[model samples]
Target: MTAQNLLVELFVEELPPKALKKLGDAFASVLADQLKAQGLAPDEAVVTAYASPRRLAAHVTGVLARAEDKAVSQKLMPVSVGLDASGQPTSALLKRLGALGTDASAVAGLKRAPDGKAEALFYESVAPGAALAAGLQKALDEALAKLPIPKVMSYQLETDCELPGWTSVNFVRPAHGLVALHGSTVVPVKALGLASGNTTHGHRFEAAVSPVVLKDADSYAVTLQGDGAVIASFAERKAEIARQLAAAAAKVGGGCQPIEDDALLEEVTALVERPNVLICEFEAQFLGVPQECLILTMKANQKYFPLLDAAGKLTNKFLVVSNISPSDASAVIGGNERVVRPRLADAKFFFDQDRKKTLASRVEGLGKVVYHNKLGTQGERTERVRAIARAIGQQLGGDVLAKSADTAAQLAKTDLLTDMVGEFPELQGIMGGYYARHDGLTEDIAFAIEDHYKPRFAGDELPRNLTGVVVALADKLETLVGMFGIGNLPTGDKDPFALRRHALGIIRMLVERNLDVPLGSLLSTAIDDGFGDRFDADVQAQTHTSVATFLFERFAGTLQEQGFSAPQVSSIRFDTSVVLTDVPKRLQAVRTFAALPEAPALAAANKRIGNILKKSEGDVSATVNESALVEQAEKDLFAAMQTTVPAANAKFEAGDYTASLQALAALRAPVDAFFDGVMVNADDPALKANRLGLLKQLHDAMNRVADLSRLAT
Candidate 1:
């Protein structure tokens, strides 16, 4: 068998920019996988993916013309059934052999094998390998079927018949051409109602030739670039666009650079083939609007990159990635400038109009806006947030902080009534901040309104001020409690309310800010205090437990994701009452305790003590009588704890978790000896009770910081 490089290309109408890269990568990977699974490609085959505005392509190296033949042994039937009594073939055996394109003569060579308890007849044959054409057709079909297309389009195709009839073809886009080549030869394959050929169209308009003919699999990219006037590889096109943007920014001769957004760069790469970076500008008056507003419109609507100065302020100039490289780009620049000016003007208009009314004046409008079907309007939700925030603020700071948080929470969702937010819902909190500042409110209130939605995603920053933190906590808890009360809990990945993110955000704030408030108390206030009549008492208690459990589970997952070992994270018995602020420190202390020389013995002994106490028939009290300790091992352990437990308790109370766990290491020898020499369930009832009490004391002390038993393995 001979091996050769392979090329596959599918040309269609413009693809959805956001989904192009994923589709291309999936197509190449799945196709290569299918080929390899069929033995038509080696395990070490190299695959390259190419995608553009109008084409998806892949080049795989070291593909065989046909897969190698395989030797197969298949069980036919029970030997007893196939061969009657003696050594004669039965009618059933003859019929089975006929189905395999063989006759009675072939039964002489059949082998006998045992299947389970009974002996069975086995048929041995050599299965011929699939040719490249058939293997590639299967691979191509699988690849297309597996692509992560955002949406599919159905179009009619004209069949090649004496009387041509329209046939419908469904794909991500209308397929126009397909190219499949092995070395320099075309492979016979069909897909999307089109036969595979060695030619493809590229660049729509700028292509130097129509129906660009590919010479070979190895030369596809080079030939396409030279004659098709296109850059076939998505990565190369993206890098080229980036290089051009940087160079164009440098040519502007100021301390200015294009705003860095990877998603924007990727989308623009997919929107063009031969990227020609051109500088365009809008009026400087638009800079009076917030840079976020301007940047959002440009990237979201026009897919343009906004320029930023050394001060990180939006500049009047921006960069455009044009597909065509015209000799003089003044017209292109002017056209883009003309197109963006109105968008900037609209933003300015919205900003100016939104400031005419203070956030407080718009509070009544939220009553009409629905928040959730079960949970009243946004107005009602706002009131609940205010109550929760006030409660949190009183605990964190005094009455003064409570007043600020209440005010901030009251006006937080007012921006939803503003035209600016109506046009862009992502700017709800941000626009409210601007309006608050305009209304002569304090920066504290303004920033809190802006930051109440902070940590909206993982790795995002938390609120900058105490007021902001208090409000953010209140808002997240309200949603968590409300949704859980309604049984809208997230299942797997279908988090319509983004409950997972909300839970993680709460965990981040509690842990990072080191807030001292109990998680259970916050859920309690949100359910009972804030949402008074919304949910019944039973629902409140259940929601509190459910939300608390959800938060802790998310927190534990976060700790594990941050590189903590599973056992370490699991060591902390997280529950509704566990203070998240103390978890990181406890985990660190556990890590330190695990490294001690006596840690293994202590951990194993602690595990044994736990099991013994669990198996006790009745409740075991930690209070042990010194007079009842007859065994020398128990006496030694009690004596050791008399000195050690006090010191460890003092360290634990002082928040020196590491010191506390380390102090218990001194009892490792005594604990090991006690377990080895003394039976917890003694013959005498008093002795058993005393031993159980002593073991309970040791278990409680060892597990205060973390369950050392978890570290046993």
Candidate 2:
């Protein structure tokens, strides 16, 4: 049994709950990796991470007492400097002579030095130790100290240093102290100048000013409870929150679900030192605004959860979680209600004012604002989006969004001119949607008005409506084309325009929406639209290819994120580099193709085919004359290819790349036979031409699927 454990906590003013939730998981992953790197194995374990607005804490259990012992060895040179009769280290023999401690004879055999400066070195040393605790602690400290915090504070200790805090130890919040223990004994952590000590504290509001001394990790929770805090583990927090939320909901009315505000729940969990649930309500008139509007106002403005009634209607009721237990609970409820109503009222007013103007009536406003310094006005962008959206809509077999998309694109950014959207830039599409609907535009246009910014994050909702997808793609393409046209392309980590995210957003839209338009055509048209007269055809091709390659790499990354390895994705995702709509199928092909144990052999044969074809220098037109065949293997391989061609093309055309590769897989046997039995060095040039032609034909056939020869085993 191991008696070691690690407990870590970082104090900050207040952390957002979403970030706080991922922090614990990320920390555990990195910590576990560090532990394994130190060669330590622990038994049953527990790591509890809790976050309050003010602090983030973690307690790890079942840690080992020390890192496993390790051996360190230093290599000694086997040879002395190979010196010539001149007594100098020979340039040619220097590498052969090991560093120092080389052979005495080898040194003596070298040309003797007058000063005898050429002596062999002493041998190397080896050491072994019981535990690498120092190394482990150092690594742990480095990782913890560098843990990324989105925001930080000012420090008095290290003024010049970038870390935020008043103390010399710059931390995200403040590193008031640390407590490192191994089986109830302080381990004396002096790392990063924040030494481990005999004491720690409970939730700031709960145990206020009290020190907590825990015997071990298992008892840490007990100590927290005694000090009025809940150990903030996701499992524990979720279970408790769910239980309390359900019980609270049951009392009000049966079948009430805790509003599905995981983000809200997470934040509240961290905001409270002790977890408690309460139900409150505001005036129901606020519900007159869109439910989404109300929710965002509550979430972004008030940090409250908007509960839903039994019939799934937005209720005026909300759930407030307070950290401190005040004497009069209704006073707290009244206070929160007081804070939220004004924000909601402002939102309602914006909704009312925005609806007063027809969306089409405001289209002229788009031309007044500039989207980019060089890329013309927002009206120009809208024109480009309209053109592209119409194209995408046509492909989706809908003329509805084709018109609505064009309309939405024309007016999407017009909302930027509105006072409401000007005040809250993040509300561009949202405000547009409300105003468009108010203007009595079709629901399709109204939906597209808001849906253009979709898939804002990974796993975020995508545009489900056809018109929305059209405008979304149009908007993204305009951004990509316009940015690339103006030479504002992303380089390294510096993307001033967020072009990468915009490109990724476009890809996710294509993949999730299953839009089937050829990415090449779309980009080509986009390039033509943006730089029709500005650049020569050569320049356009270069730009198009660059944009295509960028999109392809991002698409490949998308595949990789979905559990595909680089090699597997690279092989199939290579030249098939069309649009994201094609990735799922291509990824499927890569997986199926790689699954064949014979892939290596097939790859080898394909390489030969490519090399042979290249060496033939575009002479595939040379016909294979049966009589010109000098060896049966050459004749047989030629015959096999003739049979494989039609089937390969058919299967490939049917999107059965898996079956196509399978058909090609059959070539392994005949390909081996042909290579083994045929010698292309026949006296007859016709036979040579015939053989080369056959190889060229086979190579061209495979290239249609992908450049398999580029794959690594």
Candidate 3:
């Protein structure tokens, strides 16, 4: 196969950078799949995509001009199945052969079935070779015609574009022009009725006002910077942003690092055809306002990256990235500065106005903010969070810092009403901490008040502070139990309350913090305490059960993430009644133990013992009758268990699950030996009863460590 490079670009006015990336890759995958489906694959294909706000370009290398021909799979009736009583082909089979362009005279012998089924099989498919490049061209034209250009619009003039008169492109921004090329040749194709060509526009500012006729793909990129205004790559744009921020901060001697806002960087990166970083600052008086207010103002209102000093203090300066190397750089900077001053002033006003009222006073305002339409107001929810935190704290003992939780809960959402948080919603927790400290709250309480929202996204930092961990648990606990009580569980895409996040947060707290709150009992207490005066006993019991199942899912996921095999974790968690909050840690121990060579043999022995003991399920416990015990193996097994039982209990009491499992492994040898040497189902009634009793003891003892028989290595 000869090699060729395919270059295609859709020039747009200005696209959402994020959306452009999705579309670029989407178009690449679509084209690749289409090519393969048509059997028109090249020796190797690669699509290099680039997009700025102005354009989306995907260049496919080693392009095939056509798709491979598809061999039709005809479910033809075999001659054996098709023949009538006279042994001649039936009229229906002849009609089918005629429809498929096949002649019965050239038919292969009837395929026969050697198996039991009577229905005969037919001939498999084979493809005849055809022009691969022609197939590719046809498929390419069809795909481009149907290419998903969402948010497309039409203009009156139609130059053979896909739509009548004018058409919309598959983007929020307008698809101004497109360039398509196959190696050095222009692959003449049309979609939306527009013909494919190598003509492109340079940077909307720098290049010719009209479309550019590019000689080739490589020069197409380089020429855009020199002639056109477009800077086509996100990587180049982001590097420029970083450099500018560093340079700007250095000039002020502010000693700051860029905040590294991924979302802001992406959005700003799109806005420029060519990116240049510029440093700017606001009035020093504006610095008196909350740092969050100034930061959000610049980033949200002006697309600026806020700089922070060495101690993580917010500097008044910001780094603004621009797309165009504008003729009037000063005017662009001045206009942005002027636009953001009023936003900062509004934030300061909200912050000052909020400080006048106490957090406790703001609690009343929470009543109006709905936690869920079904779960009542934020005020009610806060009460439950505080109550559950205290209850869980009691179970966890000193590490919970219950008093700190109570204080934190009081001030947690109070910041929701503050000017800082009102203007910058992301600063809710941070603002709370600042206000708490300003109000002379204790350090633990203030930290908890802010840190309760930790582990915001997957792989984000967890709350390491003791007070914060407790309060965060309390917050999630309340959300989970309260939402379940009101019947608003997450399903499909309908997590109106974000219960998944709350559950995930709870898992992180338990697994990472190693808090030993008896999960089952803690949930029960939350249920009882949270709805002590409201729900009936029956409703409370059901709600408690539901919440337990929810927590179990969270624990299982957390355990699996920590490297426990899913099967082992699931089998251990099969029993819903056993609530393990620190399940991930325990499962990790179990997995480590299970990985040892001894585990499989031990598991087998336990399963053997379980099968024997299951027969004695409803029977009365066999009180040992030394006179009735006839087999030496049975006596030895009983004696072994009696000694192992006390020691196993001690290890379990110490919460050393690993030691407990190891001690339980001791039973494996005796139990297996006993089964080999002794006949558990003996003819003699007295002997049979004694053997079963020993097996029961074996099952009961090992179960204390874990239901290990169900676990798989």
Using TM-score as the measure, the top candidate is 1
Better by TM-score, candidate 3 or 2: 3
Pick out the ten consecutive residues of candidate 2 with the lowest summed lDDT.
121-130
The reply for model 1, stretches above 4 Å from the true place, is none
Better of 2 and 3 by lDDT: 3
**Which regions in candidate 2 have their CA more than 4 angstroms from the true location?**
1-218, 228-239, 310-312, 326-328, 391-402, 492-496, 508-516, 533-539, 561-568, 571-602, 638-644, 653-656, 664-668, 708-712
* Candidate No. with top lDDT: 1
TM-score of 1: 0.98
lDDT of 1 at 694: 91
- TM-score of model 2 relative to the true fold? 0.78
Alpha-carbon lDDT, every model: 0.92, 0.68, 0.70
RMSD of 1: 1.3
- Models 1 onward score TM values of 0.98, 0.78, 0.88
**Sort by TM-score, top down from the best:** 1, 3, 2
In model 2, residue pairs whose N, Cα or C atoms come closer than 3 Å (at least 3 residues apart or on different chains), thus clashing, are: 52-270, 87-111, 153-164, 154-165, 155-165, 155-166, 156-166, 157-168
Candidate 3 Cα RMSD after full superposition onto the native fold (Å):
3.7
Tens-place lDDT digits, model 3, residues 655-680: 78777777766666776668688887
Give per-candidate clash totals. 0, 8, 32
